[model samples]
Target chain A: MARIVVDPVTRIEGHLRIEATVEDGVITDAYSAGTMVRGFEKILKGRDPRDAWAFTERACGVCTTVHALASVRTVEDALGISVPRNAELIRNLMFCTQMVQDHVVHFYHLHALDWVDVVSCLSADPKETSRIAKSISPWPKTSPAYFAAVQNRLKTFVESGQLGIFANGYWGHPAYKLPAEVNLLAVAHYLEALEWQKELVKIHAIFGGKNPHPNYLVGGVPCSINTEEVGTINTERLNHVGSLINEAITFVEQVYIPDLLAVAPFYLDWASVGGGLPNYLCYGDLPTKSYAEIDSFKFPRGAILDRNLAEVHEVNGRDAEEIKEYVAHSWYRYERGDEAGLHPWDGETEFDYTGPKPPYEQLDVEGKYSWLKTPRWKDHPMEVGPLSRMLVAYASGHTDVQELVNETLGRLDAPVTALFSTLGRTAARGLETKLVVHWMKEFYDALIANVKAGQTRTFNDEKWDPSTWPATAEGVGMTEAPRGALAHWIRISGGKIDNYQLVVPTTWNGSPRDAKGRRSAFEASLIGTPVANIDQPLEILRTIHSFDPCIACAVHLYDPDGKHVHQVNVC
Target chain B: MTRESGTTIIGIGNLLMGDEGVGVHVIRHLERTAPPPPGTEYLDGGTGGLHLLEPLQARTRTVIIDATADGRPPGTVRRLTPRFSSDYPATLTAHDIGLKDLLDAAYILGDPPDVTLFAVSITLPSKLGTELSDPIAAVVPGMAERVLNELD
Candidate 1:
């Protein structure tokens, strides 16, 4: 038996350390640890509830608006405010736009290199790549000359001896299964996706005044519709948004989905691996009506227990017993004991670093190890994210979700059982992006119709002032972030935040084990995975990146040196 | 919208992490004290990643201000024209995507803008706070002036 530790996993949003104990070429046990500590909950204390969105929005650089959305919704939920229909439609548009754009960026930029071999693309015939690209989709950029140009660029980049970001990748690993022609084609789309994403984010800039950290109001959206005005969302801006939506739909359908389908067949065995937990959770989002109408959510809210698609248990964010967080294997001290669980409303953010100091070799996995607190749904560790959302929607009889899942499964010639693996998680992201791009059109048309009907109200100022107040109130805001289930709980006292807790997606999937010694998604998924070479564990990256781990959102602060501390030890 | 040409001065850092936000602070200072010349724009790129590519490509030149940990004094500032990713300082605050990676992506896509990087040395932050340290805060005006000079 040998223990392989990959510290500071590259190509992820933040620092994550994975330790796997391999026995006879297969992982017998795995431990996932989030090294950074997040202080957002501590920062929000004693501040006005209305201004919390601005601060919490900086939690993660990638999923900028998800935190802000949850923050504003929590404040509004506490204040008992109902925004206008137009504001709802505009928020929906932004939400769906974020989903579509984030998924595309994840698949192409962050997750693609794991499966693609840039060095092998140098050996590919551009004409063969062009032929494969043309046969896959009518994307119009499929000529042999285009493929050749992309290949030339890659050759120059590699031969320059300055691999930069690609420097540390296991390029010629045996785990890479794609053909050279397909690899070249995927490389071309990778560059194209980068350019496409920059243009796609203009929708956020148009409505929310900026991207990265778009402006969000407490009651409703920050932007007001004025078809004739120059500063607000006007006729010209509306047209720009319309065209961008159309372009997004085309890119996802023509480029993203096609690439996903093309690459999935080469690695069908992955469909049987990385199916971690038996339970799944999703706090559904994309409300067709107001947020109160749970039945109207495009992504229905529920939980799947024991991998039973036949039933999806009802999920409640406000119920204290429904969801609770424990710190048995985390660097936190609950006022009640480490073994006891506390709901978010009664959550605490005290830090107790009992693990090894920095620059240390191994972590005391038996003791407290990770920065992420273990969150259990009704005392059961549940997997969250795209797979959970898709499974819930499928079990709920959501027509569009069912159709997409069945169609993709049919194309791959796989069974419904395959929906529980890493491939399913990745394919679900692309399929949902397909559904969301079309929803963007629906939202845009709805906003236009409301404008034409002379209903231009975007903010409700009734609860804007703190004078109209209650003594103390507690509220929970739940939404489906691009990663998975996200909820922010707030307790307002004397118009100030008394306590605030955020249970993000990564905390559910990438967290350590609970008091029962059962593993969460990240650790459990790697238990049975095979490692071809202990020195270069490319297979581990394939399964982990499938979750699109966002540790910056999961764990917060960094090493005091601000330097990336990397280490790979084989013992 | 018509594409604006000329220089774009972009400041990249996390505003929540004390001196780590020197770039954003310098951008704000320049915006207030010295206005841009004609088509030059000021952008507060919070912990910049690939998103900086489009803005960089839209302009003919770009001036980036960021905090670096290069074993120098806290307030020391230096400027360089980095042609490749390896030229960037080893440590740029905690960001999902590093500046070097973003520059590399721009180079691969072709037509990378002429970039001038201004790096300020600082001790990496251990806690979260919005206010910059005294030493780093004292140099903000000087960094802004240098960026303005580069623009001119």
Candidate 2:
């Protein structure tokens, strides 16, 4: 078996090292590692539980609001307070907006280059590109002149011999399947998506008070609603937000979703690739009605074991009996021994650098291999992300989710089982975006009605003060981040944070082996993937990027002072 | 298409890491002490990557402030307008937004803004805490003054 390592995998957030063992071109075994350690949870101890959002949100700048939302929700959950209905709708809207923006960015920018070759676009005829683009959706930027200008810009850039971020790409690799014209079209949208995303973040800034790290209060959202006062959610700003959502919806329907459907047919073979652990988990988010009512959640919380859509077992993230994290093959120490799986409330964060030193050819896979601890749902390495959420929703008989999933599979002429592969995972993201766009309208309409009915209340002041709290209280804040199921566990004692742990989406998907030697979702998915070239393992990148790995969020880290522990490892 | 043309001074780094947030410190100093040329945008770019493209694109010139650990003494600052990927420092702790990769993407796309980098030298901080250490904190005022002079 030839070992191939892609350290510091690019085009995704944070630091990731993927190594696979290949035999006769097909991967036989794979190992995934998160190089960075984020000790944010450790820092939270002894601090006021209210300030947890500020620190936890910094764990990932890209997915900032989710951590903040999760942090605040956990504190509120511990305090046993349900937020006002208006606050719930606003939060749902912010999250859904994040989902739309994030998924689009992931597809066109991060994952698309893996499939569509930018270099090949140089040969594309601008006229043909424009025609094909117009045929897919009426986005109105399809003039031949516009395509020619884009083509000229690309040509000039390529001729300059300075490929910038486009540098180091496996441009002409044999894996590239899109035609020149199609590639040019994708490249055009790729550029357009940059502008599209900038507009979407405005929604976050309007409600949450900033883009990267929005200001979130524990009791409720911080945004005020006074038409007569400045810096409030007034009629003009509300209408602006409404218009922005409309624009985002139009782009997703016309540009993003159609683009995926258009590009998907060329790579149908990917539907069978990268099918890892069939166990899936989703903490249902985006409540359709009220946060007080669990059944009103649009996403639906559940776990699917052994790919059995027929039997989706319920998952209670708060119950330590259901969810636990094991550090057996990770770079951490547990008082109960490395093999012991501990619940998040009892999660440890002691750093023990026991692996082989840097500049090594391969990891000590037999021992500690990754910084990410294996988080098991009932001792099962469950996959969490778009695929898991979609399947769970489908099994739960969410008719809208079922229709979208069924229609897409039918159009592809693929079986329902096909939903388990890399292509299905990518397609699921697009389908989920469509659902979110529809829901964005629903939530916005509800918000407007709430305003008209004079229910301008947004914050729940009942739990604003911590003096009323019990001596000890603990709660789990669970939700479906754009990536997957994310939960934050917090225990407050004497009105301060005592213990905090986060089982982020990437932690579940990119985990190391447990005591049972079970491979992570990332490792398991790569096992059967064929490596066309050891040097250019684009197949591995495609499968991994499809899951949208965010190692920065996965591994809880904090850079220690006065000590440079790592001698930077470059790929 | 070309972006809206202007100048934006963006500071990029992780504030959670003490010395690593020197760029933001420099920007904060500028915000407090000296004002920029009219129409010049000043932004807090916290460890951004591709998102920097929005600011980098459609601009006449962009200046970035970031902390760098290149075996130099803490508090040492250097100014250089990087023209190529090779011109950038070998490593930037900003995991998502590698300065080298961001510049390369723009240059490859044929619309790279003139980039001036204020690379402040500092040791890599391992632990998690808020305050910038001695040497780094002492240089913040000087770095801010230098940025203002560049604006002129």
Candidate 3:
């Protein structure tokens, strides 16, 4: 009875629970529990469409803009309206700003602890560690001080704020492979990265009117740009951000990349570890000066992966829709896959736990002991996230991302195939942030030009009508959250929400026993995690964070604020 | 001695320890509320260990909200400051010495805040869930306001 569990896998955005069953020291079963239940969808019923953007973004502070953009797009799709190009640019910028911070934080605070092994400092020659720390990136405010002072600051942070998370740490263990000096520099830069990430978040607040969840209107941004006054990116600050990006790039190249290469050889075992479901999904916008005949940004639209590698196909929100909510073995109802998933406008929820499951069509779905719904693409569980989107974009040559990736790969010494793994996935996320930031500047310029030209209308005042929504219209909207692909489905009938469903990023990465009662990605990855001790599931946590598991966008099913249940009003 | 020049509400305890950190959570909410008690400072001095001496050693008085491991059903309210030093440290986890040391420092300093301790009893000292078990969470509202009521 080999068992391993990281009760609360720290890092990432929200709350999560992971458990794995092992036989002969190898995990045979894995289950990911999205423990927190926030009733956003049920609460969004009968709400105004104008409010959905505001409310849905609050589901998760880190990816609010991503959520908001998706929500607004869904309504736009519903109404057949196009947001002005400039407005699109500005919204893209805000979302991009968020990505910058998210990537920086994830790389340093979250994943760095896993790779660098914080406790390894005990073995580090303080002189060499200090030399490496002082050389990498200096913290402006605290620089000029000796490396010993920096180390002391790290100690305080570890002891107090972080609590002895590094205590009894297994640094010299067989699993640890990175050089002591590289780890030392990474740890120091990890602290500097924290400061840099926080400043970038303030940029979101400056534009979106506060962070953790900004206030962006549907038509455009709620706040207009005033570069002369408020939009003042002082020369120093501007240069600082660019410099930080460069510094960050250097760190990723000099440290993270080399270290990943060193460690991969030791763990050549984990390359094939994960529930092998090759279906990938992506439905986010990109900025391409050259619009195709169909009017998409730079990238072509379609769901692509190794399965659909050669033949690209266009996919509307409708073609990529089919979800089933099974509460039989879960905390919530048992529903069939083809039953047309319910909407927030008409959904069912009960917190009582009764283990009952109904068999499915293809995969024999049974036993729903989770709050997560089974979301299958063409009736098969599909994986979604940065890796999926990147793979789709690269496999299909998404013009903008492809160009940037090719240019960067030409500079790296490693093979381009390495970009497909954990290191590439993480680095690509940062590159995507750059793509987003560039888009944001263009967005701001357009909005400002329009506003100064006597255009004060950043929002369209929609007198939402609750009675107009189809009594029974089943719809699902998918967007790229910072962690990966996020989706929301709703079915309404008789002027009330009947069923609402969401398949968050974690659900894709850390999925449970699916239709066939087999393992999902998170479970599959755990097979070779080599648990030294079940009490401390560090390896499992490392692999999980690498995927950037986000629980869900919470309970608010509405894309925006006003469309919440108490206020189901659409423009 | 009854009601000094200024009073501050400080919640101390582990947030993961159920109702133990209820005081801090409540204080955070209290701080976010407009028109707080005049000159009343609310601090979520999370187990600051030896760092407690600084905050407690100031102002007129301080209220320490914590889950005392005393033998009582969860949410049992016991009020004590440095006035009951001998029996106090034993009342909470050794991890809580951070709060006690600060209060002790404040008492040692002539400028101690008029202190009121709101000690909530708990069966489990450390666990997940911000919720207090049963009748305690139900009784917490009344139990929480008792200190404010006493001040009034």
Candidate 4:
């Protein structure tokens, strides 16, 4: 068996190393290793539970606010504090903004490179590109002159011998199938999207005070709405935010959704590739009414076992019996044994590096192979992320979700089973963006109506002082990040965090084998993938990118003392 | 369209990784102590991959402070004015593709900004901790001063 490894996978956040064993041009087995070991849980020990959000937000650069949200909720859960109505609405807005921003960025910047061949755009006619773009969507920027300018700029950059970030991409790979005109249109929109994303982040900047690590308080939002107060969230600022949301919605409706539909038809065959674990998990998020009401979540939560969309088993993120992280094949020592599964509340973040040293040919797969622990729901290895959330919602009989999923599939003329593959995973993100935009508008309208009604209280300071504390308390803060089910478990004694554990989204999707040696979504998905060329593992990248694996959030900081911590050599 | 006249100083790094957070540390220092030059904009470009391109493109001159693991001694600081995307150093910590691809996108849009990167060299820490190493932490003021001098 020949081994193909993509070390430090490019274009995604953080460092990841994927090694697969190919037999007769097909991947027979795969191992994913999160090369770093971030012991945030260990560091979180003995700290103020109130300060956990700040530290946990640092766990990821892309999804910082999700951690912040989960951290605050964890504290709130421990204190049994319920979020006030306005704060819930505002928090939902923040969550929606992150989802939209992240999904758009993922499509255009991170994952689009996998499908669209940028180099081929050089031969595309600007006029033809403009025509194709206009035919697909009414994006007003579709003038021939604009296309010509974009083409000229690209031509000059190519001739200048500096592709930069585009430098190392597999530009002219055979897997790319988009027509030259379509490719050119995609490239043009890609540039436009860069500016579009800047405007979107302004919403986050307004609500949370900044993007990439917004200021989040434990009990409520940091910003208070005061129309008369200067420099606060007044009418003009809220209007500006509303306008930005409209702009984002317009782009999603016109540019993003159409682009997905236009390009998806060409990649229809990808439906058969990268079908990993059929089991799915989602912790529902975007509460419409209140935090106490789980049924009101815009995206419903449940677990789908063995692709049985017929029945979605209930998944309680807090229940130790339901959600457990297995460390059998991961590089960690469990308190009971290496092969034991532990709930996050009883989780341990101790370090144990047993993999073969770096620059080695392959991981010792039989032994501990990865830093990512296998997180299982109901003892089943599950896939988590857009696909899981989409499938769970689809199975739960949510009418809008069902209509969107069925309608999108019907347009593509794809089977419902197509939802199990890489293209489905990518398309799920687009559909969910539409759903999120709808919910965002709803929440925005609700926020405004609440203001119009003159009920302006955003924070509940009743549980603000930790000094009025329980001697011991433990609680789970679970939410559906843009990724899948994310949970933060915290135990407090005398107001200080006694133990903190996190089961982030990536840890679920990018997990290693469990005690039974069942492959994770990452591993199982690669098992049957056909490799055209070992050197160019474009198929692998496409599948993994669909999941948007954020290894920085999965694994923590690597041990400097470990000889192979940061020196994993790619072959 | 006439371009906006100003320098946008972007501090890019993963602040959780000890010394890798030097860039943000420098920016925070400047925000607290030094008054920025006229028409200067400051941004905390935390490992924010593609989101950074728009800000970089809008400015005429952009100064980025980032930590580098380019085999340099700990606490070493190097300043570079990259004319082309290829002019950037090979190995930047964490969000390399984000910044590199950003420049490429800017180049494709034409009139790529003049980018100056303040790369601080230091060892990456073993475990997840927020505290920066002594040597790297000590150079924060110097890095801030150098970034401020670039404002004019």
Candidate 5:
């Protein structure tokens, strides 16, 4: 018998623990166990559909927009309505800020430590670091003083902070092979990115409510803008957002991206690990509301499907059926492996954990490998998010999105087929950033024009009559969150929540064995990845963390008290 | 001690760890509400770090509002003027960076606040919730007013 313990898996949000069985120098099985539980969906049981926006943002701080969007879309689905274009733009702007913030924070603060050494910075030549920080041209707030300020901030943060992000960094790791200059440059930008992320969130607060968790409603946003007469974006507030975006893009293009490719060669073996999942799925993205529909809310609804790498289909949310949560090798008890499909609205929360049992496929079921119930798309796996969006947009011939992809692939010197792999998924994040940037600038003008036309109403004040809403309606609402695909299904009997089922992207990726005992996306993504050291598996984390696991989905921990039936002395 | 002089007032507590900073959050609300009863400094002496000890010791009277992990319903508010004997611990290191270190440091410096009053809000500092629970998050205005009336 052997013990497997992996705690605080580097490069993921919050914390994680994935234990696996290693036999004869090869790992046979593993479990993705989240150490925290955020009962947001459980708490959301009886609340009014409109209030979902205010509450669901608690799912995850990093991807609050997706939560807000999912909540809004769910209500929209229930009401059978769409938002206006101006409303969509405002929402898009809110989503853009989160994306930029999430990417910057992840690359610099969270994951950067895995690759860059903070302790190594003490040996750096400040003058050289200063020079590197200012090398980029046409900078917004770059000067000797600004660079010095950045250095000072990092100094205070590292010195005062308890958790050493600098500990076990790339300075001495065999995996860390980036240049000293690149390391120094990244450290400087890391400090700058923290300050930069806060500024970006101001747009969220100004448009929604406050940072971390914003409050935008269904039908549309609760906030609107008017600054066309001044011919400027309320500069005092939104300027920092625009400035941060400009600074971040430059840093990514000049420093970060280049440094990644340079250091990536050192970790080339990652390409093989967690790399062979070909199935992908996305629920499409938020629909852009039109000008004339300012008072009304309308959104795009599409179901996405893909296999191999080329062919993709965009289906309506209605066409998406056969959704089921199976708990075969799971710790929890369920009706059966092949049970009737239930929308999130009608999800059964009778959590009954019969102590781990032997898996029908593998005996590890006795301690059931994980707590996550497998979510299958029509008896198969489906990938979602940036990959899904990219596939769907290309298939639909969204000319601008396609053009952006071609340009990116041309510059990357990689084929469009790269868009389908893990690397492609990561690259597609950047592409979506560009797509949103283009839309952001365009939306600014549209917002201005719409305001000039006296369109202040973003939400429909008159709501659907309770009598009008179907008593036993089952509806699924889907939207592309910052992390990827997010959806919520509702089953209404006489109106109180009968069952609520949510298939977050993280759930799809981190799921355990279903009634059929299938490996989840994250598990499947992990199969091919070469695991060198069982103790320190950075490659495995990088691949999984790339999806940015939203652990708040269905994480549970229980006390170690249970009745003992029998004990056998084998010693 | 503050009754002897009406010259200065101080507000102190942590501002992070969500509700643990309720003291600072509440005092800031005080500053925002009515004018800080003249010569008042609404300082968010976060976690009451060492830097706050000397400054607070120099104040004539100081009001501290903080999240106290006493057994009570979340947001149950209490005001304590230091006593010789009580069930509660004399010092709290509830936060990683706590107020006890700052106040104790102030005592060590031999210049602790003359009339130091602590408004403890009984609440769970951990689990993330947007709204404040029952009494503590609810009693900010009243707490501030009580401090203001004492200062006046």
Candidate 6:
């Protein structure tokens, strides 16, 4: 057996180290480790519950608004605060915008290079690439001259001997299967997607104060709706949002979806690989009516066990029996034993690093290894993210989700079982983006209708004062981040946070082994994957990036006046 | 692409990590102390990423203020006009997309702004703190002044 390690995986949000044992070109065992630890949860202790969103929102720079959303929801739930319809609609719009933007950026910038060979694009015929682009969709930038210009620009960038972001890619690897023309087509769209993604987040800026770490309130949204006023969600601002929504929908449908379809057929074999765990989980989000109405969620909340799509299990966040986090193979110690599992309300963040120090060769996997604590749904190491969300919605008989999934499956000419692999995970994200852009239109219309009806109340200040509290309370706020199931649990006493825990998406997917010795999604997915070259394990990246791991959100350590943590030297 | 003629002062850092947040602190100081130059806008680009590409492309010049750890003494300030990603210092803060990568992406997409980076030297913080260290905080006014000079 040969051991291969890919430390500091490139193109991911934070630091992640993956070690896999390969036997005869196929991976037999895998280990996922989150190198950096963030102490955001520890920082939230003894702070005002209302102000927690502002601090937790800094947990990640990539998935900016999701943490704020979850934090505000948790506080609101604890305080029993109900926001107005306009506030709900506005929040829905922001959530959908994040989903659309994050998914597109992931497909084009973060995950595309694993499949596309930029070096191969240099050899592609511009006319042939243009023909292929035109045949895929009517995206308007498909002329032969347009492709030639893109090709020349790429040529200049490559010949400049300064690849920069494209510097570390395995460009000529045998694992890359896209034709030269398709590769060129993807490369052209890659640049276009980068330019287009920044525009969609302007919606967040208009509603909240800014894009990254946008302003949030405990009762409702921070921005008020006043069409006649200058400093609010005014008429011109609303019109700009409308146009941006239309532009986003067009780009996703015309460019993103078509590119996804054009590139997927070549790697259909991936549909059987990287289908990690048999169980899937999704805490549904994007409320159609109110958050209290769980049935009204467009995404549909549920879980599937043993890959059985025939039945969907309802998921409740407040139930301690359902969701529990175990740190048996993690760096932290639980007050009860290391093997004991604790729910979020009772979660602890005590540090006890037992792994080898830096400048070390390998981690002792037999002992504690990763910084991420293992999260399980009812003792099952369930997979989360786009694939889980799609599967749950499909099994729940969500008409739009079912129709889209079936149609895409038909196009690929693959069976329904193909929905369990890396290709399915990638395809589900694109399909979810298509669904969300339309939902964004619906949300926009609803907000405008409320404003026209002269009902523009965005905040509910009845319980804004802490004196009206019950002295002690606890609540859990759940939302579907672009990553997967995300929730923040809070316990408030004396109007301050007593204990707070955030089970982010990556924590569920990139966690280490549990006490039962069961592997999570990241490890299980790489079990049977074939690596063409041990030196350049592109296959490992393809499977891991499919989960779109964000380790910064998973492991946190905050010590404002404490001792210095370990040092990491990156080459 | 029609580029507007103006200077955009962008401060890139995380406000939660001690001296790593010096870029944002400098921008806040400049906003409070200095009057606005015509066609000049200040942006708090928290942990810089590709999202800054559009705003950068819209302007004629971009002055980026960020903290860097290049084995220099803390609070040392250096101004550089880096044309390529290779010209950047070894360590910027831990961002989703590094400043160098963002610049490279902007350049490849065309209409990239003329960028001038102000790298403030500091040791990488191991703990999370909202306030900058004393050495880094002492240079905030000077850093703000240096950034204002670039705008002029």
* Model 1 agreement with the true structure over A15-106: per-residue lDDT tens digits: 78899898889999999999877666887899999999887777777777888889999998888988888888888888888888888888
Model 2 chain A lowest lDDT segment of ten: A560-569
Per residue, candidate 5 scores C-alpha lDDT tens digits across A365-409 of 434455566666667666666666666676555777788778766
Query: By lDDT, who's the top model here?
Result: 6
Best-first order by DockQ: 1, 4, 6, 2, 5, 3
CA error at residue B54 for candidate 6, angstroms: 2.1
Superior by TM-score: candidate 4 or candidate 6: 6
> Who is ahead in lDDT, 4 or 6?
6
TM-score of each model, paired residue for residue: 0.97, 0.94, 0.68, 0.95, 0.72, 0.96
Clashing pairs in 6: A37-A556, A37-A557, A38-A555, A38-A556, A38-A557, A39-A556, A39-A557, A39-A558
Q: Name model 2 segments beyond 4 Å from true.
A: A556-571, B1-7, B28-42, B52-61, B83-86, B90-94, B97-114
**Model 1 CA deviation exceeding 4 Å by range:** A557-571, B1-3
CAPRI grade of model 6: acceptable
DockQ of each: 0.47, 0.34, 0.06, 0.45, 0.07, 0.43
Model 4 chain B lDDT-worst window of ten: B89-98
Candidate 1, CAPRI quality class derived from DockQ:
acceptable
Clashes of 2: 17
CA shift of A60, model 1, Å: 1.4
Global CA lDDT computed for model 6: 0.87
DockQ versus reference, model 6:
0.43
Clashes of each: 1, 17, 68, 5, 34, 8
Question: Model 6 compared with the native: what TM-score?
Answer: 0.96
Give per-residue CA lDDT, model 2, range B1-152, as digits (tens). 56556678888777676777778777778888767678687777766555566666646878889877787888888898898776876444535435676676666455667999888887764346667898889998988777777767
lDDT of 3 at A373: 50
lDDT winner between candidates 3 and 6: 6
Candidate 6's C-alpha runs over 4 A off are A556-571
**Candidate 1 residue-wise lDDT, B1-152, digit = tens:** 23467998889877777777789899889888877889898888776466666777778888988888777889999898998878887554455466777788888887666899998888864357778989999999988888888865
lDDT of 4 by residue, A213-318 (tens): 7889888888999977877788998888788888888999999999999999999989988989888888889988887687898888788988998998887767
Evaluated on CA atoms against the true complex, candidate 2 attains a DockQ of: 0.34
User: Local error of candidate 2 at A342, Å?
Assistant: 1.0
